[model samples]
Target: MDLLALETPCLILDRGKLEKNISNMHKRMKTLGVNLRPHGKTAKNIDVLKMALEDQAGGITVSTLKEAEYYFSHNIIDIVYAVGIAPVKLDRVVALIKKGARIALILDSVEQVKFVAAKGQEYDVEIPVFIELDCDGHRSGVTLDDSLLLDIGNLLHNEEGVILNGVLTHAGESYNCKSVGEIRDMAETERAMAVKCSELLRKNGLPCPIVSVGSTPTANFAEDLTGVTEVRAGVFVFNDLVMAGLGVCDESDLALSVLTSIIGHQKRKRWVITDAGWMALSRDRGTASQKVDQGAGLVCNVEGQPLNDLIVSSTNQEHGIISNRMEKDIDWDSFEIGSMVRILPNHACATGAMYDRYYITDGSTDIIDIWYRINGW
Candidate 1:
């Protein structure tokens, strides 16, 4: 089926670009001599996961238990729930463990460790765990000098039903880096921090086997991965405006886009309106702080080539307003009402969550496959 024939405001994935992105990242990780545990949170589809797992160690990192269950059901069992686990969510984790899923939980608090241990004991499961570390203070995790690091490690290692698997940290601040050199520095810091925490654990007579660290920017620019066991990156699978703005990927490498049609025009305001609004494109303005601010998205022709200086300047719940950044008048005839266009998102993960499936294409209008995505939780 042709992509234009499908309903407007849908997701279109370029399979060729997607495959190239995955292959390149795999090669990069291989060169660094670290295992690639691709995060499933970005592309929540099993089809994408299968392609990413190639040459990997069969372990996946997920932000939610639903992703863990969905991927586990597809036989990709080695999993890491990368978010700080809540006491209430342990039952679901335990259920997956009992079903033969080697799921690892990450948390930074002693309270979480106690909860996990109690749940594991009650369920008779030896739950694997990773102590989350704060590499750059971007989000959750314990600091290197924080005494809680050893406290949690000791509790996890000595607990009855919990096994301290290792340490994990994400260099989320890499996204804020202004240059590739900055990203490289953040990558080194991320790797060094995780490795140091692991060393500290081992120094205290505890086993720290898995040392994980990653974020798309850090993963792509890391010059070394000396003691790191695995790298977890997700947005690399579908480069967005944010990744492009960060120089982690070129704009041409973006593989995910929203397909929409021109619905109306305001010649007075030089606005080209479309059915794809924030509801379809998402409200993530991740590129706003970057050098280039791609509004809602960068407008593209039907062939996926970016239009000259065009962008979705604004959006309502169900209407996207396309305009030129230079404030030039649009060639109305070239974008007549009902003419189809594609929008490259600012954040692939956020935009992807607005859709339920991907209309796969090999860089063409001809739709080749329909890949379903899991949402919620």
Candidate 2:
């Protein structure tokens, strides 16, 4: 069955484009001599995870325990919970570790060190943990100069059941970069900080072994990996409007799109309503800060190409309004009911969560497989 055969308001992943994206990123990272640990938060489908691990050593980065459990049950051994795991989730972490999954958690505070150490001693399980260093003060990470990384590293090293693996960081500020050249510089600086912190730990005799750095923008533009050992990138697997705006990838490289059918139109309002709304495309206005703000999503024709003078201006709970980006009037009669269209999402992660399963289209653009996704904690 083709795309038209699938139920309306469904998500679809083009097999050819997905493979091309994976191949392109793998080739790029291999050229830099760094390990690729693709983030699993983009496409949580087991099929996509298998495709991501097919060429490499199969190490992955997951944002939550459920994702870790999902991949681990499918034989993904070396996994890293990239998020700062809380104490409430230690039971799930211990369970995954007991099942033979070599998982590591992220920590940026001495409080976390004490928490993990106390929990490890209580559960009698050796939990490997990584200290997150703030490379650019973009998000959750400790400053390299704060001595917190070493403090936490030494604390864990001296603890009874806790093992300090290494350092990890995400250059989230790279997303706000002006150009790919800026992104490359950001990558270099981010890697340097992570490496420098790791060296500091080693100088203190903490035996910092694993040094990790990850960000989609930096990963795509990085040409230097002198001290970086591994790179974690999730959005690279499914390029979105944000990636496109940064010139990281072209519009064609986007693998996932929401399929929506025109349901109604209002001539006076100069808008066409579709079955897809915030529920189908998500409400993540990722392009709000970009040069061109994509309000909800970019309107595309049924063939998956951008529509001329068309944009999803606004979206409700279950309805989407489509109109020209400018204030010019539109011929609502041209858009007949039952016309199917695709909406390129703003954030691939948020949009992917809006659907339960993906209508896997093969090389022929026919619905071949339906890959289910597991949600919740």
Minimum summed lDDT over a 10-residue window in model 2 is located at 49-58
After superposition, candidate 1 runs with Cα above 4 Å error: none
Top candidate (TM-score):
1
**Residue-wise C-alpha lDDT for candidate 2, range 2-50, written one tens digit per residue:** 8886668989888888999988988888899988999999998788877
lDDT of 1 by residue, 1-377 (tens): 99889999999999999999999999999899999999999999999998999853489999999999999998888999999999889889989998999999999999999989999999888999999999998989999999999999999989998999999999999989999899999999999999999999999999999999999999999999999999999999999999999998899999999999999999999999999999999999998999999999999999999998999999999999999999999988889998999999999999999999999999889999999999999
Inter-residue clash pairs, candidate 2: none
Per-residue lDDT value at 345 in model 2: 90
lDDT of each: 0.95, 0.87
| Global local distance difference test of model 1 | 0.95
lDDT of 2: 0.87
- TM-score of model number 2: 0.97
Q: Please identify model 2 stretches exceeding 4 Å from their true place.
A: 55-57, 331-334, 363-365
